[model samples]
Target: MNGTPIRLRELAPDGGGQLSKAEQIAQLRAQLAELDGGAAQEQIGGEGVVPLGGELANVLPNGGLPRRQVTQVSDTPSLIVEILRQVTEAGGYVGVVGWPELSYAELSAQALRRTVAVPEPGLDAVHAAGVLAEGLDVVVLHARSEIQFTPAQARPLLARVRAGGAAMLCVNVAVPSPALRMSADIARFHGIGRGRGCIAGIDLEVSAHAKGWKRPPALLTLGSATGGVTRLKAVPS
Candidate 1:
């Protein structure tokens, strides 16, 4: 995808000469497969894994997020930001779709520069994500409440992710056979002892479940103390 240009076309039908929504999506996937040049089927070991940082590495089975797979995140905005930031910092391109609430300012300058954002794709969120995954290292898609995809609708999109060797992070959408499932909850706040000072850091209880295996919960700290960065630590069992 280095020399190839990414042009996003409208999903609407253009008079009598236009392709239907389904046809347009099919065309996008076909184009992606051609642009992929069979790279997705090639296995290069570590090169295929996105750097999930040391702390996160400890919890994941692959020691990082694996390319050509879809991972589901349970709508943890901060965690999502951290994941995208890490991917971008590693010189990978990222696409964010349907997350109009996500603030780009929260991302590092480097991440912000490398990210492609599609804040609101209306009902075409899934279609937009598939197209972005064709060329990006990672794509974060926020599932729309009104649009629930059946298994039939997900297969082609997931195929696109695999065909391009890109990871898809689905927020609050349960797709079939996700490689990993992660959820985060705020456990407590630090540096606010007795309510005497502003919150300097936050402790989050994060869990990772891979297929039939479930790892012990991990503790992640995020806030001003760490310069608003995420620091993950495995809590002792």
Candidate 2:
């Protein structure tokens, strides 16, 4: 709580000393937010929103990712990559914890470099996120299916996220409250030559919901040719 940044090394794995370490990091983030007068929370665009870009933007009530809040995402690798790419391309720093399965091949070189990744945080996933949130714009925590996300564990991390002015993306993790809950599935694949040619693109059915509102499901495409995301036109019903 001395207003000093918590280094990655200071993180303690879950054990007798885990809770105290988590608390320390949380306090540091709170102090940092206070020192900055919550400037990050007061960002101008859409009242501190992080634009996800393209048609995906329209899917959110705020037209983008909510800053200083938590959003739960399904364990869809492509969709997660898209979110990270957009955030980093927009000049936001990102931290990813406990997602060793995520592929960065689609991410731009610059974006990949700007990301701080902890493939395995053991039992300190939340603590690692808090430390990274102190300076990163977004912290993604991939909760292992075996590990439960209890409210006791989530409250402090959620507080750290708000105080640090960073967005938290929980994959396969359930916390008490989240600004948005999102999930996506592959609708179909394009350009397959009877199992002869490689897949060229995929159509994704994305759903986003919030406390008081929900956007109509969206169809998006990730094409190998363009290696980018775009809103796919809905076919006439």
Candidate 3:
């Protein structure tokens, strides 16, 4: 995906149309829970896993994204680090496919567990997701699944994540196209409220068919997954 340009002609029948401003706001709120680091975060099974940082947790669905298969957080490696931290907890076999340097020797070892690091960090994302979907507890989908795949091709991959109950994090160079990335569960990014060097007040937008039929756009301030959670606005769907 480095040289290849991402196209979003399939986002809607007309073209890559933007989500209604109102709808975007609704989705953002739906994905996020509370703001600030002042919140109690309990893993699904009551394990106290050390988080990457306070900033990243607030951006997720439950103050942090869960490992239940195919949960993709669309952002950069900094954001992905926060997600990887959660995946290494108990009941979570973490696999960072297609992000070799960022996943293995480059990451803070304390933040990860027995990671199955993949070479060629950019190209292997989708392939690694396939292998880890059922065998692992969580998979960070750093590949651009939304760009190269048809909905039909992506369905099975997403389904495997669902069936396997694994979490996914997609590291995108650009905003994702809606047509290529739809699923039963989603935690969306609304926009950034305010920020400094690393700390930020980010507005996260989201909607999930499973969490609740009520998928509305809303807002929340997100912190850092590593130390610098570069906040950005949502790409118009």
Per-residue lDDT of model 2, residues 1-237, tens digit only: 123231222344567756465565564355434423432343324437777776677778677778788899888888888788887777666778887666777767667655666676655677778776766667788866845568887788888888865778888778877889988999888777775878888888877899887667777788774565455443322
Candidate 1 lDDT, tens digit per residue, 1-237? 122232223344346665666776575455444433532343233456776775677777776777878888878787887777777777666777777677554566656656666665544677778877776678888865634567897888788788765788888777887888888898988888774988887887888888667677788887787786677788788
User: Where is model 3 more than 4 Å wrong at Cα?
Assistant: 1-58, 89-91, 101-112, 121-125, 144-148, 173-237
Query: Among all windows of ten consecutive residues in candidate 2, which has the lowest summed lDDT?
Result: 1-10
**If scored against the real structure, what TM-score would every candidate get?**
0.77, 0.77, 0.45
Query: Per-residue lDDT for 1-237 in model 3, tens only?
Result: 222221101111112664543443333223212211211123333332222334334333443344443443454453454345445533234556555446232334433333444434332345446545444445565543445566666665666555654455555422223212222222433333456244333344432222432334322234543244434333243
Q: State candidate 2's TM-score.
A: 0.77
Candidate 2 lDDT at 83 equals 80
Better of 2 and 3 by lDDT: 2
What are the Cα lDDT values of the candidates?
A: 0.70, 0.70, 0.40
- What does the lDDT read for residue 81 in candidate 3? 48
Residue 214 in candidate 1 has what lDDT? 64
Weakest lDDT window of 10 consecutive positions for candidate 1? 1-10
* Candidate 2 collision pairs: none
